[model samples]
Target: MKLTLQILTLTSILLPLSYPIEFNYPSVFNFGDSNSDTGELIAGMGDHLDPPYGMIYFKTPSGRFCDGRLLVDLLMDAMDLPFLNAYLDSLGLPNFRKGCNFAAAASKILPATASDLSPFSFGIQVSQFLRFKVRALDLLAKGRKYEKYLPLQDYFEKGLYMFDIGQNDLAGAFYSKTLDQVLASIPKILEEFETGLKRLYDQGARNFWVHNTGPLGCLAQNVAKFGTDPLKLDELGCVSAHNQAARFFNLQLHALCKKLQSSFAGSNVTYVDIFSIKSNLIANYSRYGFEQPITACCGVGGPPLNYDSRIACGQTKVLDGSSVTATACNDSTEYVNWDGIHYTEAANQYVSSQILTGKYSDPPFADKMPFLLPIKF
Candidate 1:
């Protein structure tokens, strides 16, 4: 009995809350790196040097790696929703059910980077969420209502969960390093991600929107630091190597999702092509009032986003033989790289708009897609 319970506990920690749908409003559950961080890092762990980071806008440091809101927060705002608190934070059991975001800065889908942060893994975050559900159940079972929160059983068939990670696992692993060592580990990493997805589906999650990766090589921090031709492109606005990898990942993700949808029979799964949309944004920043996509608004003096990957969530800069700030751009909205690795709030908004409006597919965005993904539904 003890051993069985332990195994279940370990599995619980490694899996996510795949709940059955039961509500109208989407519970904005997020999982990724700094791009969607929100105030979680401000809750601790990030070190953006304060003031100047969010100075131009927010007026106070919000854990975002920019002057204002992150993509997740902005999406919530666009949807007319509240900023999701972490599942483990101050808002007790009663308030958690509405929606909870479990993303942590520097967190990745790969387990190898797990050791870096107390060896934390992406699976652990999901497990923690399951435990939260258990807590809610316990609270209910004890005849103690947690502010009368609604249960999945009560809501039934209308909920949503957006999964955004994979980028950290790929980019972080090969930022300073090359994709040389990543080849062997890539499959395993992807397998782990697949496991997490299956776990979520098993838990009753009906509608899911899974976003794939973007062009990591083109991020301004990389081109500025590594010196890639910024404006040079083969009509697609993507460098040869970066787009190749991104395309491959997208293809695989698409296939995996297709298999899952067919295999699951009645599941409503949506695979969002964030890669193509992001590539379009970078390739056509000029269309959106930006002039550059190959440099970050804030980063240390060199490529791949400065700072040796040791520090995140702070002001970064570069100086040539003298002390001068190197991490910032004249205006963040004009550039695609926000602090080197993530996109700016504007970029995020644009992409979300693409996802919502209709600019993400082959031509008309969704016309080329095989399945009819209902964005409004």
Candidate 2:
């Protein structure tokens, strides 16, 4: 009996050890907007440096807009990869051996204006990647001591290329164009995205993970800005027109992903349905222990939204001849929206959990992905 028990214990340990590896992506090259900006925006524009931004995890502003890690950070943890350093980060020589992030806050597929915080468009980011590739390869060829900090040539072909932009492209249009006009503009925006993707493919990227835009109407900023008219509100108190636009954009984006998969031979292009996952989270916030679903945890004004365009998070601005500072809530964990526009770290963590489940992805992650680290609240 003792010999049999020892054999069973040994088998159990070996069985887990022999589990087959599935998605063994060597590196992840991320391209997106504010949703995945680790510190690129701060590096580029020198903004978002304030208290309450990285309070939960970093204990100080770490250039990320959230109180803790973003969706990209959580995904990296699950993949057993180090958090991606921003490509533009000039601070203390950033290591790029694993991967690099080209995402920037306020960036979009289309070109940005001079006044824009991140003038780096999707094309610009692609160009930056091209530049980085050349420079890093040169350093490695020279046998520089810092070559260890750069990615090998094969990593580009084997790495997973991730994208999570386009929300801002849709949101910005609402300010200047009618709903129909905004809907009409999606094809052009996606076409630009296609051009960038093709450029990357030419440079030899194979695995792709693309996230569609979320429910724009449900955002605290939009609810505060466009939800004044009761007729515009949907069943969930979100702007009906904005959500409609978002869904249309997502549908087109999904179709584009399908087209790209067929177009790029041997490329595994996976489109993740971020809209449904985020919508479900907002609709069922209470179930997930979130109280303020459509309210900003760190913004001005009160009640339904607590967001003010005049004053940013952690900024003191004069309103009605009096100064008011946009401070954080007592507990950020109970809120979904962080600074009217961005999501809280707690909310990002929840979204990451749902994504890893694979149900929200088109063609589903399923058994293909193995978690290296479990998500924590």
TM-score of every model versus the real structure: 0.75, 0.92
What is the per-residue lDDT of model 1 for residues 155-184, given as tens digits with 9 covering 90 to 100? 322455667776666655555555456444
Q: Write down the RMSD of candidate 1 (Cα, Å).
A: 11.5
Among these predicted structures, which one has the highest lDDT? 2
TM-score of 2: 0.92
Q: Count the backbone clashes (under 3 Å) in each candidate.
A: 26, 0
Candidate 1: count the clashes.
26
**Candidate 2 on 230-311: residue-level lDDT in tens?**
9999989899989999999999999999999899999989999999988998999887778888899998888789999998
- For each candidate in the order shown, give its overall lDDT on alpha carbons: 0.58, 0.86
